[model samples]
Target: MSVRDLNLPQREPSRGELPSRVTIWEVGPRDGLQNEQTVVGLGTKLEFLDRLAAAGLGTLEATSFVHPKWVPQLADADDLLAKLDRRENVRYPVLVPNERGLDRALALGVESIAIFGSATETFARKNLNRSFDEQFAMFEPVVRRARHEGLEVRAYLSMCFGDPWEGAVAVDQVVTAGRRLLDMGCFQLSLGDTIGVATPGHVEAVLGAFDDVTRLAVHFHDTYGQALSNTLAALRAGVTTVDSSAGGLGGCPYAKAATGNLATEDLVWMLDGLGIDHGVDLDALVRTSAWMAQQLGRPSPSRVVKALTGG
Candidate 1:
């Protein structure tokens, strides 16, 4: 489907909702720690998630169920899910790449799973080792099976704005892929600026192409220092959810220059300044980031952490 085919009305929010409050889905435990050089024990991962929940984060990406050969870091997906302290208001989502991953997640009684696809064929091939069509076909059964098992499904479309191998992705391609996932019963779709090259304009253009039936979330990296700006653009466009990491953890291993996901502490600071309610304890969250940084043997990339703790 083309951008024009989307047929969405431009309903700009009134002054009261100019800078709307957004739901921050913390991906620190899974996406953040998975890329760390030092392997964090399963117990530590659980503790980190517990602190994140205590800090008032309602949604957390708990782990990925990929094969051990592909991502050895998340090989403990079953153990992580089994030991999770499932709260009444919080959701713990795991990434499931295919039927095998889905079976493992389902076996562990996971209620929600995220499946990913790439906007560009090149990225799809490199990231999933399949063509766009092949990857979609692979995930279709996973989504259908999850729905049958009464599980909520989320779709992540990476490299929505640009790709390392293929530059300047068309807005239509992103919309098309997004619509397909939504049509397949994905509860939400996360549009990812995988290489962190997106700007505010790109955010607007991409979001403008989607209809209201599909809930949207923004995932950005800080490679070019555009993550926060792009997030603001998405918020202005009425996006209600965002994906971020604690202490700015997890840069793309595939993209050399890409930075980490947007820092949760920094995002909270911005939300607080706008009088947006995130319910997260900024001080505690900062300390959590510091703790993670110490574990990783690196300085926390969150500006709020550096400023608050004098790191």
Candidate 2:
């Protein structure tokens, strides 16, 4: 019984103008574990990264450099990077909240860093402790210095479609915030459906507002069972990078309603069926997530993992 024997997700040829290749930004190591009640040890985290890299996830969000006061789970970011087995083919990106976090990452020679932003004012204040317009001021210097220091920078705009406090976020508002981050030298902008309330139409409209889709990526949560649908909309609109959590292991500490992220295994299955070239081994990914589930003392939330492993 090998992975080949599974014969899952029957591949089919591309039907439309969708990109043949997609970049799946795996966030299970960072965003996926940040909200966990139990702190996963550093050795386990390192092995998790190794397994994900072996499974062919090119870009892995390794961990966050936020202060221990905020996210104690990722407080070992410094140690994790120090002990990590760096791979030439894989890109390890860490989240740097502000100047201090960037300094920590720089001290360890981190090559890539991601900044978190908010598409709505309420989320901005709650998540970043800054006003809607004020959050940019906090991120500008960080992004600028990261670029000047020759590090790849990514921006995450949370609450893109709808916020818990704010019933519905305007498309223009998301575009404005996203553009500001992009203009500040972010190489990529990841639009986050923090509460996962976005539908296909809203996803299309939000992506359409942008002039360039090349630098855009979508990070959808499956809170409303619409992550896959919204992902299809993004692909139709020409977005090639997608953010997903392995094992669907994440939620927002700030947003009570926010649930687990779109699972990497589930996304890979859909990509496989669509004949999109993601370069990830679905069986390996499912096994990795399933193993992670055992570590966390729960079953993986990925539908594909369940279907394949009969969990």
Candidate 3:
């Protein structure tokens, strides 16, 4: 599949914040805490997720079903899902790597699930130990089965702008993989700046290539202080779905230098200022991130949190 092959519907130019409501997909629990070096207990993970939920975030990525041998920190995926707070109107999505992982998620009656892929060949092989095409081939049946079971499937495409080893990635490559994921039954596609090198201009260019903004999500890392800028650019490009971590607590395990994701606190502050409705309470978000920072025994990397809390 190619960018031209997507046959996406024509879209009008964006008017910033035209869509008053945006979905802030919180990834602090699964993507954020997974990169922590120390073992964060199951109770702590649950507490962190519950705090985020109480802060008014509706969609939360709870955990990953990746093998314990790989991501040991998230080894409690099953246990966490088993006892997670089932709050009304709150969604708990988990990441599943393959059929086996999907099976586990299904057993728990997971409402939503996410599968990850890479735009570049090198990162795909490095992360999933498979070629680019093989990666989706691996996710194909898993996504189908999960959707068939009435689960909302999200396709996560990483390294959308710059690959650590591959340098600049072609926009068409991203479109191709994203279209394939959507074609394979994914209801949403979250394009990620895995190494955090995407700038605002690149964000606009890439997002412009996608004709349908409703099904698109943007995930950016703050390695170079560009996450918020890139996020605003995506918003200006008509994207209403944004992925962020609370307290900025995540990094790419495959790319050693990949830093924390865009902090949900930072995004909420911007959205609040712009009069955009994210449904998140900035004060509560700050409080939750502050508490999470304490749990980690480190200052939060979020500038907004720092400015607000003097950490």
Candidate 4:
């Protein structure tokens, strides 16, 4: 199936209407805490997510259903999923790295799951010990099974801009991967700036290559201080979904010098200033980030947190 097959109606843009109301998927619980050196308790993790939901975050990445041997930090994925105080309107998406991960998520009665693929062959081989086709093949059965069970799927394409081993990724490769995910019935496709090496120009160029059926989202790292700028660029290109961590908490363990993701508080501040209705409370969000930072025994990375808390 292709975008042409979807038969989605085309609409001309009107001046008053914004490109689209962006959906901010908070990745704090899963991505943020996953990289912590110290293991956070299950109770603490649940509390953090509770606060996030109270602060009006509608979409949250709750946990990753990968094997404990692979990601020990998320070893309690099933426990967390079982204990979560499920919100009717809020979506809790868990990361499923392969078919086994997907099965675990399904066993926990998860309705939504995220599958990831890398754009560059080197990154895929390095990270997953598989080539691009192999990784995609691993995802295919999981996607099919999930769809059979009526689960919503989100596909993450990592290293969309640049790879640690390969400098620049071709835009056509990204488009092809994104199209493949969409064809596999993924509800959304998140293009990740894995090493945070993306520029606004690169964002526009990458997004311009995709057709309309594939809804686009962005996941940016703040490594070179380009996350926010790239985010604004994504918005300008009509991207309606953005992924960020609460206090800029997580980074790629594979890539050296890679900073945490773009901070959620900072993103909300920008969106609020732009008169964008994100339905999130900045003050509460700042408080949540501060609490998480205290638990981790580290200073908060969010600029808005510092400014708001007088740190």
Indicate which candidate wins on TM-score: 2
Scanning candidate 3 in windows of ten residues, the lowest lDDT window is 1-10
Q: Residues 168-265, candidate 4, lDDT per residue (tens digit)?
A: 89999999888888899888999999999999999989998988623889999998899999998888778878999998899876676688999999
Better of 2 and 3 by lDDT: 2
lDDT of 3: 0.88
Relative to the unseen true structure, what is the Cα RMSD of model 2? 1.8
TM-score of 1: 0.93
Instruction: List TM-scores for all candidates, in order.
Output: 0.93, 0.96, 0.94, 0.93
Q: Who wins the lDDT comparison?
A: 2
Global Cα RMSD, each model: 7.3, 1.8, 7.6, 7.4
Which residue runs of candidate 3 sit more than 4 Å off their true CA positions? 1-17
The list of candidate 1 runs beyond 4 A from truth reads 1-20
Candidate 2 structure quality by residue, lDDT tens digits, 1-311 = 22335665554546656888999999999999998999999988999999999999999999998889989999999999999999988999999999999999999989999999999999999889999999999999999899999999999999999999989998999999999999999989999999999999999999989999989999999999999999989998999999999998899989879889999988887887677889998878888899999999999988888888998
- Which of the two, 1 or 3, has more TM-score? 3
RMSD of 3: 7.6
Off by over 4 Å in 2: 1-16
Per-residue lDDT tens digits of candidate 3, residues 227-286? 999998888878899999998889989998899999998887777656577888777888
